[model samples]
Target: MTHQVHLGIALERAGWHPAAWREPSAHARALTSPAYWRDLLRTADDAGLALATIEDALSLPDRFEPVDALRPGRVRGRLDAVLIASYAAPLTRRIGLIPTVTTTHTEPFHVATGIQTLDFASRGRAGVRLVAGASAAERANFGRRDIGVDVFPASGRVEDSPEILAAFREAGEFADVLARLWDSWQDDAIIRDLESGRFLDADRVHRIEFEGEFFSITGASIVPRSPQGRPLLTVLAHQTVPFRLAAEHADLVYVTPHDDADVVAIRDDLDAAADDLRRDREPLRVFADLLVLVEDTAVAARDASQRLDEWAGEPLTSDARVVVGTPADVVDAVRELAASGVDGVRLRPARQPADVVAIAEKVAPILRSAGVLREDADGASLRTRLGLTRPESRYVGEKVAL
Candidate 1:
């Protein structure tokens, strides 16, 4: 294949629009409402998107250095991502519904079980987006003991650099342990044998007693092995070391390519990591994420961009690298990113349903003509559509290479 592409949408809380709640199409009710998420997933699935992520996030008040901005505190958001996906599961057929769950506060036991439930409810189409936040406001929602800022390594950490390298190592190890916990149960352990009056095969289950500097999680899961063995594990990484996590673990990795040139660097780095880790499994699927406002004309898109910036409390700065252009221009950017060695993209719409639908109608056709989209996208389960194999039912055996 020349390239592979999968479309995914993250239902960001209110989607970067302060006035989104006031908009007619925007949900005025709870974001946690089943109906609201169901509609969004249905729309995205109908439009050929592969995944619709119901991302749960505890928003830290947007820290403002200036005196006049909205003071930092807990912002508006309250929804459990895993539960939302579970509820949305029976509502959609083809689209994979992965929800965000933080490893920061959530236990591997609970998180692993939740994803397994999602896989069952959706008939094996569930994935999890794992994110770790270091903000005090977000930590407040967890309400355990206080996890000070130093608990997580500071940003810009390097081997010989300023930030605490140990902290990054700790967090990375925790994530690895979380993934292992998700697989602790053997697939066949959950044999429902009413005839024999026996419930499960205990010997098949493995207990993991992983003890690390930052954490020490013990043994087998309360839930049976998931249908997917492990649902698609996705992680977002902005820098080099973080990207290494994706290289070793993630089925999908989302990164922002600074330019066409940057795509090469990201791909090369990931490839090197895979080789270093000796992971000769599937080919790595790297995807570029861009916030975009597509319009009939470049100027029209620019106008929409400016409006969003105004809502963001300032003109959009260089910090958020968003694509603002006509469909043709946006197509060019996507094509370039794909050529720079990526499987696909997770396009962030600058606006609401309009931009999303517009991209599907306009930009997608261009990609189709370019032959980047996969042919198997039609008439397949999310796994089959992604060109991934259907895993053995949660009652199988495996060899673990230590």
Candidate 2:
């Protein structure tokens, strides 16, 4: 059977391009409004896309410059990603809402409960993209740990810095705590029995008591076991440190592979890491990230990309491979990626609503017809849709000795 590739959208304020806000079709004035996110998410859901990952950060997009000296052209400001996902949940039924949550500054307990609440709200359609906040501004916002100014060096290689690597290591521990907390409450822990006036079975809840280099949690989660046992854990990895983190903790790993060979190489690295780590569970899923600008024709797409680049004062540059073409071109690209062994592709649109509409109306139908994209199964949870089984709680069989 041909492997059906999962499709997702990485939603930014207006779009991924720095100058996307200047576009006539961009919702520049309403970036924080509920209607803007609602429309975009509804489009993705209706398009039968598998998931939508909301981008977030504690600091503004421009990390280097002072807030007062920030450039005027780029878009700025965003509401809380978890809150946005919760707001969009009722409005969208099918697509998984995976919001980015920075683990460096935020406490693991808060992250665990917040995502648990989101999972409950979305009825198991929620996931979180784990990220480590590295900027001094973001660190200042929390007034927590002090990181060196040169954590992100001139070479643009993040893993080269020990501080950054340590942050990722902390994030891995953060992910571990989140998972343990999610499994703290057994599935049947809650029982509303009027006869005995019993609200919960105390025996069924387990204290995780997780102690690590970054965090130490000593009890069961305040929140009950979520619908999927644990919502999906995801990480966007570009190098070895993050690749190992994803292999060890993430259910899904998003990778920036510039070409087919890159895809194969990344897959090999992930597999090797998983092997070295002695991962005993199901292998994590890999999704290649693409920054896309699709139009009616190749010329139209190129023209649109050029226009955006001109507006931005530079050509579009992304960690992911940039694709500019028509629906057929996109389909061919997806087909190639599938052949290259990627389980999915997360497309970051260069423009809002316009590229979103194109992906839904034009691109998706062609892929579905080609057997590359599968139709969404009605009423399926995000895990079910992704072919992941709902895991039983680790504390299920552990009963309190009388």
Top candidate when judged by lDDT against the true structure: 2
Q: Candidate 2, overall lDDT?
A: 0.87
CA lDDT, every model vs. true structure: 0.66, 0.87
TM-scores for candidates 1 onward, in order: 0.84, 0.96
Per-residue lDDT of 1-402 in model 1, one digit per residue for the tens?
Answer: 555576666666555444434444545565556776676677776767778766566543542222134443213655788888888788887778888876565666677778878988887788888775544555565677454343334444444432334435655675677567766776666688999987876767766778887678776767766667778878777666767767776777788877866777877788787787637657656668877767899887777666666555665543235778988887777777766767767877655565666777887777777786555544455566666665443324653322
Which residue pairs come into collision in candidate 1?
187-394, 187-395, 188-394, 188-395, 188-396, 208-219
For candidate 2, lDDT tens digit of each residue in 1-402? 666899999998899988888888888989989999999999999999999999998887455556456677888889899999999988888899999998888888998999999999988899999997667777667777677333465677766787787888889999999999999998988998999999998998888978999888898789999988899999999987889999899999999998877888898889999998735777688888988888898998888888989988999888888889998888888888888878889999989978888999988899898899966687788888888889888777787421
Off by over 4 Å in 2: 63-68, 148-151, 154-156, 400-402
Alpha-carbon RMSD, candidate 2 = 1.8
